[model samples]
Target: SIKEKPSSKAEKEDENPGTVRILLLGAAESGKTTLLSQIRMLYKQTFTESELIHRRAYVYNHIVSSMKAILAFASANDLQLSLDNQQRAKEILSIEECLGPFTQQEYDAIENLWKDPAVQEAYKKRGNFNLNDSAK
Candidate 1:
């Protein structure tokens, strides 16, 4: 085997920089878009800042933005549940899953569930999330 020596600043500069990739997923108006904006801005990256800010502003103006309070409540409850994990991110969620792709039964169940007093109470107490373990 050949020995390799560490490089100096000029040598390091000759090499290309590493790349990082992130993926965002959510419904329309979810903060996936907003978060991406904040990330690019906070990084002070060499990109089109005005365009990004304009798009983020448009999302806020025309779409539902992130909810701060209900999300905090849900995070607190989830923390209390002791789900400490590094493999996955800590999430503040919404119940878009409950609506699913919409079978007739799921659609009817959704309409009925929305009117449920208990469901409303749960939403207020915790963040909106589907409690049902199995979703089709």
Candidate 2:
């Protein structure tokens, strides 16, 4: 007995023709993921509450890890910090403390810390570090 070839319908089903597929590609530091996230938010349904909670936790972890790396770089390089920024960094580096729901003052302090020349330089050097793509 001879076997018959699969039909086009079978091929399409294997490819999941009903599903939309998107590919993002760009340079190392480019915002491809950010653009994809924006597209998802604009075109797809909003995230469920549980998804939002999960994402919040992930964001917090990412921020904490990034801050720690910056601090380590600063320490290794003997980077100077203003008295106020030093205090702010201390608070941010406190892993035990819960983050988010920031008060206006805390928000301002964090923003200022990020804007500091040392922090800015460190941030620019982020390309030197390797972060898992999943974290982005």
Candidate 3:
């Protein structure tokens, strides 16, 4: 009879000589960070205050970068936005000038701009680039 393969834990120990190593590889924005966060939650149970703070910063960065990309795409395509949305985009881009946290109203305004149909259409065009079908 053929022998069964060893358990993953046993195979890892054998390969690393007592040290287990996991390597995750993927393209950009391919859910690597999300996967790592899930794994961390499963194995570590909870995050420290500092880790939570760092995660918050990462989320904020993603939001800001996404906003910037949307604005850039709109401008490049000469896509017209409503006066309100235009003002909101300006406010979002000038957050550094205020040197303060965003108010709830400002956050709502940004979210609204992001949900605009024109913006969504523009985002769909991005599927022509490197983004995979799932990401699109």
Q: Give the best candidate by TM-score.
A: 3
- Report clash pairs, candidate 2: none
Q: TM-scores, in order shown? A: 0.28, 0.55, 0.64
Candidate 1 on 1-136: residue-level lDDT in tens? 9855647865555454664566798975466866886887798865577775665555332211122232344455653322221111122123232211434543454444434443344455542453321111
lDDT for position 34 in model 2: 72
Q: Sorted on TM-score, highest at the top, how do the candidates line up? A: 3, 2, 1
Runs with alpha carbons beyond 4 Å of true place in candidate 3: 1-30, 96-101, 128-136
Tens-place lDDT per residue, model 2, 10-117, is 565656757676678899647775787698789886777886777676566666666667766775667776788988888777665434455565566667777777
Summing lDDT over every window of 10 consecutive residues in candidate 3, give the lowest-scoring window.
127-136
Better of 1 and 3 by TM-score: 3
Residue 4: error of model 2 in Å? Answer: 32
Question: Candidate 1, residue 93: CA error in Å?
Answer: 32
C-alpha lDDT of residue 83 in model 2:
81
lDDT of 3 at 48: 82
Q: For each candidate in the order shown, give its overall lDDT on alpha carbons.
A: 0.42, 0.67, 0.70
lDDT of 2 at 10: 54
